[model samples]
Target: MRVEQGFQPTPYTEGNPFTTDPVLPNLLKRLLPRDVHEEVYGDLERFGLKVLTTLHDLTSKTSEPRVVQYDQWGRRIDDLQTSEGWRGLKAQMQEEGVIGIPFERKYGEFSRVYGFMKQFIAIGDSDVISCPFAMTDGTSRVLELVGSPAVKRDIFPRLTSRDPSLAFTAGQWMTERPGGSDVSQTETIARPVSNASSPYGPVYRIDGFKWFSSATDSDIAVALARTGPPESGSRGLSLFLIPLRRPLIRPVDAPRPPALTNNIKIHRLKNKFGTKILPTAELSLEGAEGYLLGEVNQGVKFITPVLNITRIHSALTSVGSIRKCLAIATAYSSVRAISGGRQLLKDNVLHVAELARAHLTYRALTHFVFGVVLLLGKTECKVATDDEVLRLRLLTPAVKAFAADKASGVMEECMTMLGGQGYMEESRIGTVLKDAMVEKIWEGTTTVLSLDMVRAAAKPGVLHASASTISNMHQWANTIVSSCPADLVHRLAERLATLRICVTEVISAYTNPSTPLLSRPTLALFAYTTSALYLLEHAIWAHESGEATANTDIEVFRRWIDEGGLLPALQDVRRVKTAGADRTKMDAEIVYGNTSTTQVVDDLPISARL
Candidate 1:
């Protein structure tokens, strides 16, 4: 047999995603007791190995889920057939209490941090099964928030159950053809079902279509449906908990049905560009029975909890994916020979720099993501200060958007480092990149989330709290620099000052008429500035604790600041207006592509000129 010449695969590392690197665990040790860290780290290590197997199955393409819309008898069944690998993942997640940790209260206030960290570790190897887990976690949290006692009593245990057979995953069915992120345009309608009742409360018959239903195999869903007139917009909507399948177990003697008994009809499965193993469906709900959750017409407010949770999940997934890709690239670099027959790891200076930057990106994003997670933990435990809650609210979109934006770039760069081998489907690098692309699009696109950050910032007291937090970070940096190597201190100090100035400028720009284009840059500035501050804190921690890798951590921070890592592209107002005008014209020209900007500009008042 002719073997492929000059190819060597990197051996898999067998251990914990967290414990192997003491950075994350060490960072947590600053807050938790040593014993607590050890216990949490050990638990993650054991389960991480199993999760690694799931990753292997996913990368090897052995767990692609398929939709079977009809039975062999040509009757509608609308069943989802997933692979054994997928089943194993679901079972392991449930058994491991992956979705239940925060609610379990075993770890008390730190539980949310623990839960989210476990998710962050598991996501790299989770085959994106974390999708359903996110929804399940969010759904459970929403139920708790809305005070749906009966629903909680009946569904909460199953949502958090350790038994796979009993555990139920949930879907967030909010997207529709008319509204993707603007949930105010929701078209799904909920009509009162006369004399009907559910575990939650009064029953409603749901009717309409959901355009993008993720985790379609879930047992139940939390959805938004209009209970008021169509003109009521988001205010008219009501939240509902709809079981995909009736809860009653069918008797063995019961007659077999030709089609699924539930009213949810799977119209088609989306042929997605990535996440091929998870089934996502476009569904029609024709008279599907549901129980109203929360007060009528407060669906948006009720579902806010779920959105926050899912957004955090999305951020974690981005970081996790980037981490895994970087790991693969690092491993391959050690073994693969590059240009001039040199070991890629040893002889390539630029390659080494790229790798170093990737590592830097990973370290920085870890802090940013986990900072939010820690805040989330505090808020959930009702121990968070007002400032912390405000920070969490402001940072959620920033972290999610920023991580996703950087994560895709990280994967692409890592894949490029793999060269020819990276393009191969079997290399799994492409798959990682493909899957990561959706992250920025889902949860919310960067532009959408940037605008969200602006809205969040505009809220009363948010900007002031944010300013205080950044100031506190600056003080922390100053303290760290007081003791660290002298060569780096001045530069770090300068960068910190730059960060403060940039933040202040952006804040001012938010209200300035001439700087109406500050939305995107301001959000980017917020994310990058905060992330740098977090990186500085971690660096200080590593140094103060005398970790062996403290110098390496310090250098990453040094490079980040020296390389203009904290500086954002701040355009002058004149240029911004010019660009705005150009864009407005271009947008007018393009019904499809390019049209006439003259018509648009001609109609505008002088004061309203682009």
Candidate 2:
């Protein structure tokens, strides 16, 4: 018997990301010094094509890491055996400086821009190895803030090494069973050791269970343990660096240290719906050696640096994944045959429209996330002004939450464009969707992040500063739009005005005690306004800078606005308080109804009732 094959999509071409997105190089050209941009761009191009593409292929073939608790001789040895493909890819990442780029600072002020652009591309092919990379980057940032001289001398170099043999990854162990994001309820206990033997100073013994440890096979971890009495909450907790294995340093010339237990026991791995390529495990630390970081009882404040870094990672993961999805969907639509003997790309107006919108979304999110990345780079380089610093603090949570949420919706639409095939495991659409969902939940949930935005806006001068920045961006956009088609420019101008009004209402709602219910909606409105401003700016730049596809870029901006991209919330300042009060009343009524009635009942034996 003979079998017939069906239509299949040609695989997406993997090459230099700089070439893939002309806008990226153009953005870099404007942001970085010419000499620095050229060098950084060249190196990243080579790494992206030669190293990242190969690793992406390898990652697709690798299985999840398996944990072996005992040796064949019945000796206790907790070993995490990962696939050759995973190991090979990890080695390549080290050699390519995927995790080292930002910390190394070889490219100067624009180092982070170059580094983040590389990360943005690498993540698409990263097989969720980016999970560990995110935590590792966060750990590095934390150490930079508080690590002792010895810790910095011995660990920072190894962490930032481009040589695989000497490099190490770090994990973040923060969550516990009883307390999810509420670190105030942390139950982990740390007892001081007067004369402990360790490279890091002020050693402590940790005893607690971590509910979620994403990178179980990592060399070291940053954890939180209560150094004060049980009632101390977040204030009583302290941050500690614990080596997963003793003698954490890996010297290139010497043989790797012998398998030494660190009293960190892996209870079980999480059977997650997505990111199966990364191993997330539950761990129990009993008498585990850890070195206290920073002053005792000041862990919460210090941990913010790490969280800030990881949150950016979460945003990158979101934007990168959606970009990949758009690429796949667009390519598949171009080739797949449909009605009237026409390809889906050419014949289907609805499909074409979907692709156009997805493209617009991808562009907007790219700018939003990258904008944050640039701010972070400036902050790190000590070149940022006070206003920029304040904007960075305000925008971080907003961008992370908004981008992650928007990516999920965009990916879903892209999946729908692929029809039934997108649902299959072999297509990997479902995998990306699941992974994107995790990004929304991790780092911080939408609700939690919205509250953070409220807090930031409430800070003195922050709201006004953000408003002024948006106004300046709008003026610049209007100047660039002057040369474009009149109707399109007018529409954009209208949207920009709505954005301004919405921002004012959002700030007002947040500040007023009676309008607590407006917090989430206000944050959403703020995000929409910010995203629209970014898209407008990108369109303006494309037109003025004579980018390769200026006309198409302008059209994307038009479509984005035409499709109701920047529509403000219906609840403005006038209605926010009323809506909030109504919501609270309804909620209370549900819990305890206004019509109260009571009835008494006599208990009966179970057998008699039956």
Candidate 3:
């Protein structure tokens, strides 16, 4: 008898993300001017091929970076060494103008859309290069808004440069030992340097320890330091531009400044759960020289733009990771067989359903992020109306939180579809999953973001403005759904009504101090409703435009509105209203685990409780 080899699954071959993504091309076509769309489409196709080939290979071969704390002679040299692959990726990112596109503003209000679309496609394989690029973009925006003219002339060009040698990436250093997200607890101090100034701003000597600093290898950073009394909280803080290495001396021709001459000491690099290839470190800034970006004691206000931009980047990262994982699972399913090799996994209805569900989620998130991006672009171009500005403020945090919360589950679903192959590092899905998990925590945890959304909603006229926008979306969607089956139209109308009721109830609770507010759930309800509206609007556009994927788009919209758990969430609003005390008691029991004293203490209103 002859021995036969066992079966082997075919290797996964990834398609060009820009061209192969089911939703993006159509989305761009619908949103962009025809000529602009055509131009970007061609460019994206070529870039997409590079992403699948060059970028993919670079990220695959890249090793985690390491910090060499000392040299052979016991010299304290904090040399951050990264792989050749990492360097190549960075070079490509600059050469491709990944961070410069929006700043270049070749397309006016659509520039951000164009830039972010490229970012969304490239992020999956960029080896967390997006991390530094995001900070660079945010830093550039801050300088654009408030930097001294000298700073812009000297530093801004480098930030947006397409020439790899001329380009500069920036880090954001805000977290300290006393605070992660709470800048109020920041302990860094900046003491002014009299009769000293640089092209950047008024010079200061900063002395503090930054507990967590990502993009540690970047050329420069925007850091927050206390310039006021210790008791002043966040209002006492000030923003500064800190060059990571010492600047060259004033002479026209001079040797380079000695390493770490600025007194930035890299205490240690973090061993993180994900984004391993990116360099992150704790730093002691002992008399590190920095330049103030804006007015003193206004760091929080000046840093808002950076936070908003970075949060948007985080949302894109989350959605992009999910898209990449789904792509891998999808390609694998086509080659992998099931039922004793009688059928491919792609042919299995249950597997296909799971894939479809994940795709639906990806599609919804893409729309949400891009919608916010469009608003940002408008704001940047100075074309955003007051209402548009308000809508952007309300939606930014909600969308960021929503996308991040959905990403992990979608990643898990894709991984499961690939079985054991997905669990392996070789698949790259595991790596994406790991890196994507950081999105939730870095920008802000879901709970923190939910509270932010609640705060935004509570702002005068913000809630009403958002409700008005949603109502407008409903009217447009109703017109589109009118021609469909009565039941489908009825369902759409009912959901809209529920959304209105939820918004009304939230406003009522806000107005009436006696009513308990469920901040997290309210965010969920609004985010889900907004996502559904955006998806429906897209479906209508696709159908009206006679796009090839109109039917599929309509199906996605239907499944999202009907089976996406929005109805259950709506129903739960009633239960929450009636069962607040009971729910509170149960929550305390679950957390304290039958400890009566703890439960009683926890159940008390926050004003009366610890």
Which one wins on lDDT? 3
Candidate 3 deviant stretches above 4 angstroms: 1-5, 248-259, 465-517, 594-610
Write model 3 residue lDDT over 1-610, tens digit each, in one string: 3345565568978888988889889999988899889888998899999999899889877898888888899998888888998889998989888889999999988989988888889877888899999999999999999999987887888899998777778999999877789999999999999989687789999999999889887878999999999899999999999988766223335443433788998888899999999989999999999999899999999999999999999999999998899889889888998898899988999889889889988988999899889989999999997767877888899888989899999999998888988898888888899999999899789888877876776665665335445432333334534544554456466654554565555554333423244666666777777777678778777776778988888788777777776677666555565665667778878887778786799989999985
Clashes of 1: 1
Which residue runs of candidate 2 sit more than 4 Å off their true CA positions? 4-18, 197-199, 250-260, 464-491, 562-564, 568-577, 587-610
Tell me the tens digit of each residue's lDDT in model 2 across 133-205.
8888888888887899998999877777788777888899889988899898999999999877666869899
Please identify which of the two predictions, 2 or 3, would achieve the higher lDDT against the true structure.
Answer: 3
| TM, every model | 0.88, 0.89, 0.91
Is candidate 2 or 3 superior in TM-score? 3
Provide the global lDDT of candidate 2 against the true structure: 0.76
lDDT tens per residue, model 1, 198-218? 657888989899999998888
lDDT (0 to 1) per candidate: 0.76, 0.76, 0.83
- Model 1: residues with Cα > 4 Å off, grouped in runs: 4-16, 21-23, 54-61, 248-259, 339-344, 464-491, 511-516, 570-583, 586-610
Task: Tell me each candidate's RMSD, in Å, in order.
Answer: 5.3, 4.0, 5.1
